[model samples]
Target: MDEQALIPDSQQGDLNAFNRLVLAYQDLAFNIAYRMLGDEARAEECTQEAFFSAYRHLGSYRGGSFKAWVLRMVTNACYDELRRRKRRPVIPLEPLNDTDEEIESPAWLASSDPSPEEVVHLKELDTAIDHCLSTLLPDFRSVVILVDVQNMEYEEVSSILKSPLGTIKSRLARARQKMRDCLQGFEELLPSEYRHEQEGK
Candidate 1:
């Protein structure tokens, strides 16, 4: 199915067409929200809200990447949630550690069938990654999640973020650097292969 056609149809009040588009991108939207907020239930709520917001504003979408357009709504929803969280501060169970560095070629981005040992290791690594992600400021976190975690290109990220290309690049660069530095402290927790995956890069 052509995604472009569905966009115009959705704009014209085609609920069925919009539903198809939703089915296609819901996982992406949810994952983004989950990554942004770090809470499953809140992520679900934000994703649903974003889709509703997207539907209401469908007519305002000029032709471009529909995925990015949908994602803009998702990010906005996530931003709103984060702002709410700020207003209701809570005591931290863990502390944040800040640092800097970049990883353009992350080995973890590779897909594969995992062995039992690999599976266990991956769970630990994921937790470490999530912890590091949670420490980042929302803007930096969004850039990293979209570019590195979501494997989106900078142009699409800029579109989703509604920022200048240069600004996106800078934020992503800083975010990656921060992640690289933060993950170094978890070198013992992560596998040898995972730690060295981006050596050349």
Candidate 2:
């Protein structure tokens, strides 16, 4: 059944309908969480929490983009997680080798069966992008992540953020500019196409 059909069913206490909706949206929600929080474990936690909150508040949802509504919920969860992180910080401890040097290829951070070259490239690009994203203010970061990373339209982003169109436009523009500036420092690590584009600019 379609989402409109599913929404009402879900609102009427249909767990099956809601589970279908969850299957449809779990990836998007988890990706939003990961981009915002930058950790797979925490993102998973936020995604589960967001879904629970959404199911509880499903009745409050009026006619609009259901995807946007779900995204907004996940974003709010990320914000809450961030606040919690501030109140109680936890230090990460990486295993050290005999020389007291951090292991370069820890099993936990490894990808599944990627070619060595591909793994290196992916790691470099991910690190570069994550570093740039980390520098942005949360509002600016959210707009950019929703638009560029999540491939959301301006209208959907405006709805998710509850910001005016003009505000969205301005923030998106500033965020893109900031990202471009930040990325330039890692031009060599970027893919050739992106490196060429940067060089042209």
Top TM-score model: 2
What are the clashing pairs of model 1? 101-177
Q: Give a tens-digit lDDT track for model 1, residues 45-105.
A: 9999999999999989988888988999999999999999999866443322244445344
What's model 2's TM-score? 0.82
Alpha carbon deviation, residue 32, candidate 1 (Å): 0.8
Model 2: per-residue Cα lDDT over 36-71, one tens digit each: 888899999999999999998998999889988998
Candidate 1 Cα RMSD after full superposition onto the native fold (Å): 10.3
The true-versus-predicted C-alpha distance at residue 197 of model 2, in Å, is 4.6
lDDT of each: 0.84, 0.84
TM-score of candidate 1 against the unseen true structure: 0.79
Off by over 4 Å in 2: 92-123, 197-201
Error of 1 at 164 (Å): 1.1
For this target, which candidate reaches the highest lDDT against the unseen true structure? 2
lDDT of 1: 0.84
Q: How many steric overlaps are in each model, in order? A: 1, 0
Q: Candidate 1: misplaced stretches above 4 Å?
A: 91-123, 191-201
